[model samples]
Target chain A: MKTWIEKQKALIDFTLASLARRKIKNLGLLLVYTLIVFLLASVMLFTHALRKEAGKVLENSPEVIVQRLVAGRHDLIPPGYLEKIGRIRGVQKKEGRLWGYYYDGVLKANYTFMVPQPDALMAVESGKIAVGATMARMRGLVPGNTISFRSYSGKLFSFEVSSVLPNKSELVSADLVLLSEADFRAFFELPPGYYNDIVLSVANPLEVRNIATKLSTLLPDSRPILREEVLRTYESIFNWREGIVLVLLSGAILAFAIFAWEKASGLSAEEKREIGILKAIGWETGDVIKMKFWEGALVSLAAFLLGYIAAYLHVFRFSSWLFEPVLKGWAVLYPRFELTPEVDGFQVATLFLFTVFPYAVATIVPIWRAAITDPDAVMRG
Target chain B: MIEVSEVRKAFNQGRHNEYWALKGISLTIEAKKVTALCGPSGSGKTTLLTIIGCLARPTSGRVRLKERDISGLPERFLTDIRRSTFGFVFQQFNLIKGLSALDNVMLPAYPLGGDWRALRARAESLLDSLGLAHRREARVEWLSGGEQQRVAIARALVNDPEVLIADEPTANLDTALSKEFLAILEALAEQGRTVLLTSHDPLVVEAAVIDSVIDMRDGQIVGIR
Candidate 1:
């Protein structure tokens, strides 16, 4: 076993030297290979991190959101709607949520206006408000600054910025403005006992689905959306976007594979002579194959590491600047938050299978052909 | 001693380019002596040398080492015999370019890996003996033809095999280098090594150190001296 290890080390050393000899050609190949890996890895890392961030944003959300439907369209819950949901089993608490989208003509962006939940981190005074970090940045608001916007009812209201929402939850709260219930109802001219939706908090996770089903059955015109379903939708959306980007880059992947295949299969005259010399010196067919294997492995592993590190930095550090537009979808005021640095082992394994393993296999048959040829014939040629 | 009996080798058998390089060749080489196969191009001397070296297989007949037939052995066994029992020097030297002389000399022993320090010592000692101690670290391409030839010889001897097979060892050498190569072989032979070589060089055939010379034409032996 020691001898075998020594032999492999010797081969790796020789392979490195050999690769360095043709530095120009090999480096060009490496550049292209790294680019391919970087492209694929960036998409995977970005989407995965986005999924994780979305899950984190929804972590404390109500277990079920019941939206009333009228004429097959989402409509505001009318009076007595909360009473109608009075006694659902497994529901710890049920509350009405008031929220709506406000189109700010000045910024040409839509902001979500909502009354703060009871457990919100910051409480708003009757005439004050708390805007998200992104919203504050766009409007250049500080704690003492006041901003005014015209409501749909042709009424103007000014509110002081109590605090900027935390950056940690920026993905979901980027365009949020939390105001007191009096300010909200006055701005929207909403009458008493009406809400955009009803949120139910269930202590038992298994009971969330049961309560949702009961809500849907009891209130025929209501839609009970579970947190799991929301999470699944988020996952599918990211996956779909990732798939689209990958499909768009399929040509590049194919070209790189062909390039890898071509480079591996085409042994130059000098290379052939080198193998002939090795065999003539009593190096066995297995030994030659082993050397070639080391060569491919070193190249593949280097490219993989370099590419993955680059992609990780691109996604988590630089915000994946190259692919942000396509992956983030169309939005006027998008979040610029850092994805938590994390690596999925299964993803890395899958990437290895797609990139390194195939290239290693590609080199075997060609090297074996050269190895098995008699040294006499090769020298004579 | 090495023995060859009725060995025949054909390339691309039954094809349009079919050609036999050796035919019914039978010869015996005594241990601890220098023997030469003298023939013109296409005379099959190199072909017969390869068959004996275990580098190529014979289409028919048998080659025996120490009276043990190796004709039907598996490739792995044949490779083992080649590494342990035979070393080869080609006409072109065949030293891998871009490697130092010491590295080229150390190439043969890499497969039978054991005590690399000892192997490096042996290779260095061989180069030192051949008056190349200063050139050991120089790349093979930078070395002169005679220096390259010595490096190839060092590589062939690195494993300390019993028989040394040279296919036209002097084909690419000047007269002085060729004579120097012959003297090296004679010294190796005196050290109880069998020197098997193929060449058409008159100086090699007439060398005083050579014990016997076999002449061949059209893939058949024509004379023995």
Candidate 2:
């Protein structure tokens, strides 16, 4: 076993030297290989981070939300519905939430406006508002700066920025604004006993789904969204987007496959001579194949590690501008947030099996064929 | 001792383009002596050398090295025999080009699965004996033809094999280097290692220390001296 390990080390050393000898060609392949892995990994990591961030915020979300539907469209729920929901068997607490989207003509972007809870981090005064850090940056608004926007009622409402939300909450609150209830109701022209939706908590976690079903039965036109369903929806959306990007990236992947195949199948004249010489010098067919295996494995493993680390930095640290347009294409105001750093063993294994395994296998037939032939025939050629 | 009897090799067998490279050639190579095979091009001298070296299989007949018939063995067993018992020097000095001289010499022993330190030491000693110690770290491509030939010889001796086979080993060298290579082979034979070589060079065939000269024509042994 010690001897076998030493031989492997020697083989690895020889492979590194051989690869370095053809630095220009091999470096070019490494760069292109790294880029392919980077693009695919960035897409995967970004979507994963988005889903994870959404899931984190969902932990704080109400177990169920009841929204009124009229004529197949969402409408304001009557505050009376909250009282009825609070009376349900599993209902622990129920609150009426007032929120709507306000489109700023000046910035040409939409910001979510909501009434702040009493125990919220930022308690707004009657006419003041607290905005998110990204919102503040987009509008050049700081604390004590006043901004104005026209509501759905065609009335202009102005409020002073109290404080911007911290960067840690940027994923969820990037476009959120919080104001007092009086100002929120007046700005949206929402009357008393009405809310955009009603959020309800259940005393028992398992009974939450049961409460949702009961609520749907009681209010025929009401839609009760479960937290799990929301998470599943988030996952599917990202998966769909990832599938589309993969389709677009297939061209590059195909190009790499062709490159690998060409290199493996052609077996350069120099390579043939080397194999012939090795066999001529009393090296067995297994030994020659083992050396070639090390060569392929070294190249594949180096490319994998370099590509993965580079993709990690690109997605989480550098924000992956290369793939930003494709992933966040539809959003005019892209979220300025860092993706959480995550390393998924399964994904790394998948990348290895996908990228390295085939390239390694591509070499076996060619190497074996060279090994099995008479050394004189190959050297003479 | 190595014995060959009625060996024949045909390429493109069972086809219209079939050509026989060797036909019914039988000879014996004595241990601890220098023997030479002299023939013109296409005389099948190299083919016979390869069969005896276990580098190729014969279509018929037997090759017995120490009374073991190896002509019909499977490839894996043949490979093991080749690794443990035979060292080969080719006409083109087929040293793996990118590796240094020491590395090339050490290539044959990698499959032996021993302490690499011992292997390196053995390779180093062989290179030192061949006056190539100073050139140990130089790549084969950077070395001259004579230096490359010496490196190939060192590689052939690294495994301490019982038999050494050379096919036109002096084909690429000038007269001076060819004579030097012959002297090295004579010394190796003096050390009790059997040496068999094929050469077209008269200087190589007429060397004073050769035990016998075998001449071939049309893939058949024409004379033995």
Candidate 3:
């Protein structure tokens, strides 16, 4: 056992020296390999973080949202809707939600205006508003500043900025404005006794679907949306986008595989002679294979580490600008949030399977073929 | 002793370019003596040397090492035999580029892996014996043709094999270096190790230290002296 370990150590020593001998060529291959890994890993890590954020944000959402439909389109729920929902058996809390999208013609962006639920992440007092971090940054407004927005009825309403939401919640609140329910109704010129939707929070997850079904039967004109279904929809959308990008990137991966295969099989005359000489001097086919394996392993492992670290920094630090337009979609009022640094073992292992495994196979197959041939024939050539 | 009986070797068998390199050749190589196979380029001298050294297997007939048939052995066993029993010196020396003389000498002993420190010591001793102690850490590409040849010789001898097989030992050397190489061969033979060599160079074919000469043409033995 000791001798076997020693043998492998010697092979690794020789392999390192051999790689250094062709330093430029090997380094070029490493650079291209690292780039390929960086591209794929960035897409993967970004998508994974976005998905995790979505699930976490939705974690606090009501299990069921009941929206009144007028001619199959979402309409405002009438005043008596919450009374009609009226304490479903499994529901822990029930309330009406008020929210609407307001297009700011000046900034050419949309802001989500909503009434604070009181159990909201941050408090908003009556007649005053709390703007999200991005909104404050864009408008240069501080807590004491007053901002005005024209109503749909062409009337201007001004309110004091009570607070600016922190950046940590930017993904969910990037273009958000939290005002009192009365202000939200007045800004949209909406009358009293109307809510955008009705929300029911159920303590038991298993009872959510049952409650949703009961609500549908009770309110035939309303559509019930379950939180899990919304989460699944977002999950599928991100996965579909990620899959499309991966398919498009497969061409690059294939090119890299071909490059690796060509590099491994197309031995330079000097390299061929080296193999022949090693074999002739009493090194066996197995020994030669072991040495080549070390060469492949060392190069691939280094590429993986460099690429993954680069991708992590690219996505989390620099916001993965290279892939944002595609992976995260286009937005005028984009989140501009930093992704939390985390690695999914399964995803990384899968990436390893995609990258290093193929390279090692490409490197070993040709070397094994060469090693099995007669040393005399190869040397003579 | 090594024995070759009716051994034949072919290249690209069953193909259009198929050509037999050796034809029904038979000979005996005595222990602790220097023997040379002399022939022109197309002759079977090198092919026979490769076959007897276990670097290539014959297509027909048999070869015996100490009365044990080795012709039909598998490549795994043949490699083992080559590693344990024979050392090879090629025409170009074939010292791996970018490696020091000591590293080249240590290549054959790497698989054995007895003790790395002891192996390094032995490799150093072999290089010193070949008058390459001062050049032990020099990369092979930096060495002269004669120095490279000696490194190859030291590499071959590092495993301490009993049979030394050198193919065209002086093919790449000038006259003086060729003579120096021949003197080294004579000295190794005098150390009670069997030395087998192949060369068409007259300087090697007619060397005084060569105990026997087998002349060949067209893959068949033409004369023996």
* Count of backbone clashes, every candidate in sequence: 0, 0, 0
Cα distance off (Å), candidate 2, residue B120: 1.7
Per-model lDDT: 0.87, 0.83, 0.88
Q: Which candidate is the best by lDDT?
A: 3
Q: Which residue pairs collide in model 2, if any?
A: none
Per-residue CA lDDT of model 2 for A243-294, tens digit only, reads 8888998898788778866665567778888888888777778888898888
The TM-score of chain B in candidate 3 is: 0.98
lDDT, model 1, position B99 = 84
Q: In candidate 3, which residue pairs get closer than 3 Å at backbone N, Cα or C atoms, i.e. clash? A: none
Runs of candidate 3 with Cα error greater than 4 angstroms are A329-331, A378-381, B12-18
Give the CAPRI class of candidate 1. medium
DockQ of each: 0.65, 0.61, 0.70
DockQ of 2: 0.61
Cα error, candidate 2, residue B139 (Å): 1.1
DockQ, candidate 1, comes to: 0.65
TM-score for each prediction?
0.96, 0.96, 0.95
True contacts kept of 1: 0.58
**Consecutive 10-residue window with the lowest summed lDDT within model 2 chain B:** B107-116
lDDT tens per residue, model 1, A244-292: 9899889988898798778866788898889888887778899999999
Instruction: Name the top DockQ candidate.
Output: 3
The model with the greater lDDT, 1 or 3, is 3
